[model samples]
Target: MKTLQASRAPRLFPLRLSFRFPLAALAVMGVLFFSPAHAERLKELASIQGVRDNPLIGYGLMVGLDGTGDQTMQTPFTTQSLNNMLQQLGITIPQGVNMQLKNVAAVMVTATLPSFARPGQNIDVTVSSMGNAKSLRGGTLLMTPLKGIDGATYAVAQGNMVVGGAGASANGSKVQVNQLSSGRIPAGALVERTVEAAVGAEGTFAIELNRSDFGTTQRAVDAINRQFGAGTAEAIDARAIRVRAPEPQQRVGFLARLEDLEVTPTQASARVVVNARTGSVVMNQAVRVKDCAIAHGSLSVVINTEPVVSQPGAFSGGSTVAAQTSQISVNQGGGAIQMVRGGASLSDVVKGLNALGANPQDLVSILQAMKTAGALSAELEII
Candidate 1:
C-alpha cells in the first residue's frame, strides 16, 4: 500500500511569531502585500499544500570504530554482540569466553521515511552510539533493518559513517569540536517495503491542513471550488477539506491539477511564540496591540563580602589561636521609570523594548505580562 493513500505521517503547526524580540517590520495600510491579496481565495502564498515526509527509527550497531567503541567490559551487550559476530564468521571461542575488542559499538539507527518511498530506493540514515562509546569516528554501520511501529521492516541500512568533528585526549585533558558520538551515513538505507498510499482515491480526496484554522480551511475550500467549479470542494472543519475529483481512474490527474491552482487563503490567527530558554521571541505579521502605556524599570541587587580574623584567648601552655570570619553586603539597583508610548505596529513595540535596553531573556517576561494584562492582541505561547 502506498503511504500516499493510507497516511501515517502526522502534521505539525507551521509557523509562529516570537514575543521576546520579534522582528519589527511595520505593515502600513493598503500595502500591496497587506491588502487582501487580489487572488482572494486563489493564491499560492495564502495556501498550505504539500506532501510531507514521515519519521522512522530503529536500533542497531556500528562496527569498525577506531578503538573508540563502547567499552565492551562495561557494556555486556557489546561483548555478547562481538561473540555473535565471531560465530557468524565461522570462528568459535570456548564457553565463558571473553573478548576485548576496540572496534564495535551498539548504536541506534534512525532515518526519515520519505513520502511515497518505494522499495529499493536509497535513503540517508544516522547512526548514534547508545552505549558509552567514546566516539563513533571511523566507524561503519552493519546491516540494520528499519521498521515501523507495526514491526514491519521497511528499509535495510548499512554504510560508512561520517562524523562531523574530531576530538582528542591526553594527560587527563581533552579537547573537542562538535559531537562525535553520532554520525551520518549518506544514502545508507535501501527501502525494503513502501508505506501504503492512502490519499488519492476515487473521485474525491481529502486535504488536511498542518494547522486547524477555520479561516484557512474555508479559504482552501473556496479556492478549490473556484478552480474546478462550484460545489467541487467543501470544508469539513478548520483542519480538513474534502474535494470532489474524477472517478477512481482519474484521481491522480485530479490531484495534479489541484496542486497547481493558487489560493489566497485567509490570514492565520495572530499568535506570538516565546522561547524562554533561548531568549527568542517571534511575532507574526497578523499580530497587533491594544492602545496601552508601559512603564518598565530595573530593581538592582548588590552584594559585598569581606574577611575577618579573630585571636584566641590566652592560656598557660597554649600558643595563640587564630580564626577567620567573613562579612557580606547587598544593594538594590534603581533606574528611572520610563514610559513606553502606545504602539499599534511591531516597530513601535520593538522601539519601546529597545528603549528599556532589556536583554532578550528579561524581555520574554515583559511580553508575557503585557499579554496577560490584555495590552497585547494575540495568543502568547511559550516553548
Candidate 2:
C-alpha cells in the first residue's frame, strides 16, 4: 500500500508543473498582443464621404420688441415686407398711408439640416437682424421657410428669441454686453424635407480622412483589411480609401463594426504657428531645433519741439516773432549673441528658447531668422 501511494504522488507533481508552464506563457502572449497606447478608433480618424450636414437659410421677421425694432423710414424693405405679410393675411392697408412700425424687425434665420434627418426632427436656429435695429431681445421669430442651396424649402422655423446680451441707455449714455443683434432658439425649426444621402449605392463606399497623409491612409487600409478580410479595402490616395461593403441590408451593421476598429495613425509633422497681430506663438510637440545663435534688441526714435520768441532789440521797430526749435534722438539697445544647443525633443527645444529670455514678439523674429538660416526643422507660419 505504501508503494502505490508514493507512485501516485510523483505522477500528480508532474501534472501540476505542466499546467503552471502553460498559464505563464499565456500571460506573456496577452501583453504582447495588446494595442499600443496611442491607438485611436477609426471613426475619429475618418468619415464616410457622402454623409455630411447641409446648411439651410431663410429670411424672416421678428416681432414683439420693446421699441428696439428697425425704423421703417431708414429700412424701407421692412415696411414693404410688413405690408406683404399683411396682404397675405387678408388685411388691406390704405394706399398713401405709411405704417410706422416699432415692434417688428427684419431678420435672417439660419439652421443646419443634419444627415439622416427625418421629416419631423427639430433643429436649433439662429436669427440675425439685417437692419439697423437696436436689439432682437424679447422678440419672437415668425414662421420662416428655411431653404437649401437648391432653392427648396427643407424646414420651418418659429420660436422665441434668446439673446445672451443686455444694454441700457439714458441721458445719451449707454453700455452693453455681448451682441444684441443676433439670438438663438433652441429646437426652433422642424424638418419638412429630407436630403438624400446615397452611401454604398454601388456595392462600395469611401472613407475620407480629416487630414491627408499617405502613411495614415495605408495603415488604415491595412487594419480594415486585417479585420474584415484580404482585399476588403484599397487605398485610393493620401486622403481617401475605398472599401467593399456588404449587401444593402447589412451595410449599416458592417459600418458600425468597421468604425469601432482601432488603428495607430502616423505622427504629425513638425510645425509652428505665430500670430503676427497679437504677438502670440504656438508650437506643436513634433517641433525640433538645430544648433543656432540669436541676438535681439530694440531701436527707438524720439522727437521734442519747443516754442521760441524773439523780441525787438531796444525798440528798433522790429516786430516780435514766434519760432519753433526741434530736437531728435535715436537710441539702440545692446544685444549680445547667445548660443542655443541642438534639441531632439520638444522639451529640449523649449528650454533652449526660454534661455534667451526674450518676449513673445522677439521670439517671433528669432524663429523667422532661424528658419531662414536652416536651423529650424519645422515649417514657420505667420497668421
Query: Which candidate comes out best when scored by TM-score?
Result: 2
Candidate 2 C-alpha error for residue 226, in Å: 1.6
Please give the CA lDDT of all the candidate structures: 0.71, 0.85
lDDT of 1 by residue, 1-383 (tens): 65556756433222122334333422122321233434432323333234556667887778888888888778998777767777988988899767787888999898998877898899999888889999999888888889887888889999898999899999999999999999898999999888765664454567776667787777777777777899988888878787775777776676767767665566767777888777677766566766544444566554554455455566755565555555544544434444555555655555555565566677777788888888778898888
lDDT of 1 at 348: 58
Misplaced by over 4 Å in model 1 are: 1-54, 88-90, 247-249, 309-337
TM-score of each: 0.80, 0.85
- Candidate 2: misplaced stretches above 4 Å? 1-37, 304-327
